[model samples]
Target: MSTPLKPLPAWADVALIPLINVAAAFVISGFVVLAIGENPLEAVQILITGALGDLEGIGFTLYYATSFIFTGLAVAICFHAGLFNIGVEGQAYIAGLGAALAALYLGFLPGYSLVFVAIVAAALFGAAFAFIPGYLQAKRDSHIVITTIMFNYIASAIMGYLLVNVLRVPGQMNPETPGFPWNGRVPQFHEVLAKIGVHWPVTPFNLSFLLALLAALAVWLVIWRTRLGYEIRTVGANPTAAIYGGISPARITIVTTLLSGALAGGMAVNVILGEEHRLILEYTAGFGFVGIAVALMGRAHPVGIILAAILFGMLYQGGAELAFEKPKISRDMIVVIQGLVVLFAGALEHMFRKPVATLLARRTTQPPI
Candidate 1:
C-alpha cells in the first residue's frame, strides 16, 4: 500500500488551505457572473467595496458576524468532543424565550445587570434543552444526528405554539413578545460611541460583537489550555484510548453538549437582546444552519471560526448591496454565489489537501545544487 501523505503545517492547515478554497470559490462564482453578462471583475470590486466601503456597511457586516460567531463556537466545541450536534438552531430558538423572559419581566434591574441576567438565562435554557439529546446519546444509544434533527422539529413546534398562543401580545396579532423596555436593551455600538462624543453610524451591530470575540477567546482557552479540553480532544480522537485512560466518554458527551448548547444560546445576545429587542417568530433566520458551514470552513478552531464568520458576514452584507446595485444579479444569484462558497469551503474542503500537501513535501525535500 502507498504511504499516506503527512499533514500540512499547522499554518497551512488552518489558513492557507481555507484561503485557496475561498479563492477557488470566488473564481467559480466569477464564471457564473460572467455567464450572466456581468463584469466579473467589477462584481468582485463591488462585493469588496460594498462590504467595507463605509462605516454602516462595516457595522452591518459585523452585526451579521456576531450571531455567526456564537453558532460557530457552538459547533466547534462539540466537534472537539467528536459530536455532530445539529440542534444549534433549536437550542438558539429556545434560548430566545430565556432572553425574552428576562427582557420582558426583569425591567427593575440596572441595565448592565439585566442584560447579564438575560445572557445567563439564555445559556441555561439552551443547555437544558440540549441535555436530553446528550443524555440519550450517551446513556440510551440514540444517535445524536437523528435525535438533534428531531429536536429541531420539536423546537419549531414548541416555539410556534408559544409564539402564536402564549407569548403574543394582547390583540397585537403578531407572534412575538412585547417590545423590551429601554433598560433591557443591549447597548448598540453607535449609541455607546455617541455617548463618548464619537459619531458612528446607526446600525444593528452592538456590544455582542465584543461578546463574540470574548467567547472565542474563552473557547480557545477551554479547548487548548485546560484539562477538560484535553479530555474532550482525547475522547474525540479515540474513545477506546480515552476509556483505557479512565476518561468517561459519557460524561464528556453530556458536558460537551451542555457547553455547545450554551454557546449556541449566546446568539440571543446578538439577535434578541441586541437587535430585535423582542423575541419574534423565526428569529433564528437560518443563522444556526449557517453555523455548520462556518464551522466546517473554520476547521473548528476559535481563531479560524472568527475569520470564517467575518467572511460569511461579508457575503451577507455585500450580497445585499450587490443585489441592490446590479438588477441583473438578483438575490437568488447572490445566494448561488454563497452556495458556491459553502460548497468549496465546507463540503469539498479537503479536495485539494493531498495535492497541496504533496507539493509542499516535494518543495521541502528539494536539495540545493
Candidate 2:
C-alpha cells in the first residue's frame, strides 16, 4: 500500500526545499567544473566578486534583474490564472516598437512627460500583441501554450521587418532607430547618485529599477488584496465552481493575460530608455524565457520572484566576469550552469518532495512518552 503523505510545512514547502534544491544544483555544477580542470570553490569566489565586488558589477546585476522582475511577474500572474504565457518574449519585443514611436515623436516633450507617454504606449502595444492568442484560447479552445510559442516567432519576424525596413537609422548599418532625444532619455541611476554626491561607476542601472520594484508591489496588491484577483484565483482553482458562482472564465482569462502582457512590456523601458536609449533588435536576449525559471524558482510570488531574479542576475553578470577572467571557462559553460539551476528548481522539483513528506509524516506520528 502507498504511504499516506502529509502536506509539507510552509517553511519546508517554500523555503527549505528550494534552498536545498539550489544547493544540490550548485554541488553538481561544482563537479562539472572540477571535471573541466577548474576549482569550483575558486570559481564561486570569482562569481561573487564579479557580481558584487564593485558598484559597476552591482549596477549591471541590478539592471538585468530589473528586466527579469518584469518578465517574472508577468509569467507569475499568468501562471496563477492557470495559464502559461510563453509569448512574454515576443510581447516584450513588440512593445519596444511602441516605446520607440513615442520617443521619436514626443522627443519635443519634457523628460517626465515623454517617459510617461512611452510607458503607456509600451503597455498598450504589448497587451494588444498578446490579445489575439489569448482570445483564440478563450473563445476557440486553442491551446495557449502552442499559440503563445508560435507568437514568439511571429513577433521576432515582425520586429526584424520593422527594424530593418522602417526604423533603421539613416546612413547607419545597424538596424536600430536614431537615438532618443536628451529629454527622452531615462536618467541612469549612477547619474542620480552622483547628483547626491554619491559617486559610483557608470552603468546602465536606471530609474526603471525603481519602476520594477513598484511593479512587484503592484502585483502583490492585485493578487492578494483585490476582488478581481479573487476571481482569477477562483477560476484557476476550480473553473466549474467559478462558473457556478457567476464568474466568467473567458473574461478573466483575457483580462489576466492582457495584464500579464502589459507587465512584460514594461521591461522594454529598462532596456531601450535606461540602457540602449533607442530601439534595437533582439534587445530582450531571451530574458523572456528566463522569466519562466524565475517564476518557478520563486514559487510564483512577487517576493520570491525578486529574490530569484537577483540570483539569476548575479549568475549572468558573474558568468560574464568569470569568462573574462578565466578564458578556459567558455560562455557556454555558464549557460550550462544556469540550465542546471532551472532544471533542478523547476523540472525536478519533486525529486525530494516524497522523501521530505515521508520524514515529516514519521515525525508527526511519533508516539509520545
- Candidate 1, TM-score vs. the true structure? 0.97
What's model 2's lDDT at 240? Answer: 97
Q: What local distance difference test score does each model get?
A: 0.92, 0.91
lDDT of 2 by residue, 1-369 (tens): 986788899879888778878888899989999999999999999998999999999999999999999999999999888899999999999888888899899877865799888888888988998898889989999988999999999999999998999999878899999998876777898899889999979999999888999999999999899999899889888999999999998999999889988998878989987889899989999999999999999898898899989999999999999999888788999999999989999999889888888888888899998
Count of backbone clashes, every candidate in sequence: 0, 0
The TM-scores, one per candidate, come to: 0.97, 0.96
**Model 1 accuracy (lDDT, Cα):** 0.92
lDDT of 1 at 152: 88
Give one digit per residue, the lDDT tens place, for model 1 in 257-306.
Answer: 99999999889879999999999989998899889888989999999999
The lDDT of model 2 is 0.91
What is the Cα-based TM-score of model 2? 0.96
Ten contiguous residues minimizing lDDT sum, candidate 2 = 181-190
